[model samples]
Target: MALLPTTAQAAQTHPDPRPLTGQEIIHDPTVARLKSGGYVAYSTGGIIGARLSADGRHWDDAGNAFAEPPAWWYEYNDKADPWAPDLSYRDGRYWLYYAVSSWGSNHSAIGVATSPSGRPGTWTDHGKVFSSERTDSWNAIDPAIVRADGRLWMSFGSYWTGIRMVELDPVTGKTVPGAAVHHLATRPDAPYAVEGPYIVKHGRHYYLFASYDACCSGVNSTYKIKVGRSASATGPYVDSAGTPMLNGGGDLVLEGHGRFIGTGGQSVFRDKGKDWLAYHYYDAEDDGTPKLGLNRLSWTKDGWPKVS
Candidate 1:
């Protein structure tokens, strides 16, 4: 016989154990699945190589992806900031959009490169996709692309204002001129910022997920992830609680302290009949250095999603 049915034992338990901390440095994680059934993550810290994992945990670094900086990188001398990178598969090619710029400002541009295979040593720079003008009001960075309803869309920006989206030609991987780019979301009232736009589709709606608050500067950072949804690809998205994301309507999706902190710059992927959220977060115990974090996402009956 066993003693059971105590009040504490019968109560609802939080799914997460205490927050995880003390991880090695890993930032700006980009996830891709190989044909060989393994996963690859390309991250920051001069780490241009792939991290191979058969089960998405326990990884081995495959060395730097690029042996030398391509001639086109203007600030290649200062190689610290690799920033946000978006990876996609199109026309038997693997396309990567990466940013090299000063953090949190528009003194930057997004560059495009492609590879015949998803492996390293095969990338060819396609040139800059978009850059910021000194006179412009918004910061141009963090390029995320997706195909919806037979159209290609790229969403990008930082705390300077909010996230914006523009139409793209699926064939050329370039912006479609005269395309109506519009604001998708922002947070003027929040403490500091809204940035890192990662968009995806679910059911009849398109969802835009972004990180908020200060991302750098260690334990003082207030970084977290929030989300908004809309019925159209170019959105006036709303949060789960029915607030307008365009009007700063967003609901908290994930935050940090115990296992993760400053968790944002996310990408969503579907694998093995399940959805996974891949993002970077600062390790709590390692003096707030950023690292890769993976979580499983599930949908509610009402169509909203949560990480489990």
Candidate 2:
């Protein structure tokens, strides 16, 4: 286990993202430290846009993950573009899961793909793993995968009733047929606005991180990231004050600050034995352009995560 940062070090740390250069523009990025060395970031644009970095600080645009969208994607949107991809490595291969949908519509699906290397243009599409329709209370987008107690689970949702989870087949990496949908987090008020769920385990508890409020409105975007923790993977998660996330409980993680406006849509990964938070923010200094945000994630002495 990594040593916990002292309170003095935590106080001196900035909540803003670390300085980055070279092709930093991206949205809803999921970054993975490559087994082959360096890193790759996949995001919600251009048939699943990709960026590569030899060193963690500088990046270069690589290209799209797929040359063309699958035929089924057109059923959700005319352009067939995918969004909010989540990438993970397991079972000796890389698994890429992404969502397809039209804005403001609940007709959506999450699809899976595999690659020997977690690089752009190398993935093989594996069709839909889960989906939702207008009649359903939960929208099937923004997936985050987590493994716990020897079982695989996927947490997803946006806008409708809030965050949800379903078990996945370990062998196929798809939703287990007849698996029950488990509610995770949401606002107590209607039109729940919360989205982009990412869960990470720390010590004895599972922490759920998610974005709350409006996103994608440039400088006006109100996006912010918050978190809660539960003893089990699927939970009745609560904030520091003991308020249930189901009742709008989440400890603030990151919010808009100065040049970094509307920071949210986050994912966490481990690199060189240290955990890092990866997300995007609308840049006020750059006319609200979406740009990558990276920050080292440290644990408090009490075990809660703190982004440095």
Candidate 3:
């Protein structure tokens, strides 16, 4: 892939591009374009770090969502550093789904919180929605949600068993009882390290985007984004080459290039009449400080998503 830049973005001469200048730095972030005509992103850190952008190009630190760490977080992660939050506006309230866990441990949990206004320190933690233990085959950390056909579904996982999905109750934002768990994608080889799955439907297909390889190790990070698609929300997703995602199939959507190392943990949203891919990348030159990454998406005539 040529890694085309968005038409409206300022042109830069790097072979592997970096986001435009200004106050931009984040990791495992999700963007929400507020009705106020600004962008708000929640990333991993203190109650999940927040930043606001008046123009979506320049940002300033907002604050964390929680005034203090929630009581239950210590059971999952004492650091209270919530990870990978998926933010969305639901039922007139802002819904935030975040993960809690210590490093390299399957003892993790995914929690939910709601706020009338989607601003930092305004969230009311609702507590754990799902969790997993070391004995479990899947590590339940990174979380992403999508509303499909009036049903809510969560896609999450990390090392140990790859990505998995469970249907959510739209009203309560919890798992639907008796819902079948779907094991969607995994890398079979050693270092089996696929995580962070986000789903979006365009046309008739539900596209599954997941981060592949390791993350969180700064410049040594090997993370990249890959994708597959299915006709149904409960997927049997296959890559462009027609291999089932269950068998390790995923076509590359974006990867590390030049000074931008470990580009992954992506979220997609349509705003201002254009589709965009929001993610994070390590700045190799900045001693691997994770920074926000945004790239507009343009679909091919045949319906495949390509980074613009």
Q: Output the worst ten-in-a-row residue range by lDDT, candidate 2.
A: 6-15
Q: Kindly indicate the candidate among 2 and 3 with the higher lDDT.
A: 2
For model 2, residues 1-308, the per-residue Cα lDDT tens digits are 99988765453324778899899999999999999999999999999999999998999999999998988999888999899999999999999999999999989999999999999999999899999999999999999999999999999999998999999998999999999999999998888989999999999899999999999999999999999999999998999999999999999888888888888899999999999999999999889999999999999998888989
- Between candidates 1 and 2, which one is better according to TM-score? 2
Q: Considering summed lDDT, which 10 consecutive residues are worst modelled in model 1? A: 11-20
lDDT of each: 0.74, 0.94, 0.88
Predicted structure with the largest lDDT when compared to the true one:
2
Name every residue pair that clashes in candidate 2: none
Clashes of 2: 0
Q: Kindly give the number of clashing pairs for every candidate.
A: 5, 0, 2
- Distance (Å) between predicted and true CA of 92, model 1? 1.4
C-alpha RMSD of each candidate structure in angstroms: 5.8, 5.9, 5.8
Show the colliding residue pairs in model 3.
4-308, 5-308
Deviation in Å, model 2, residue 258 alpha carbon: 0.6
Candidate 2 is scored at a TM of 0.95
Per-residue lDDT of model 1, residues 2-94, tens digit only: 987767455322234223232335666678887667776776556354566666766776655566666656553256455677877888888
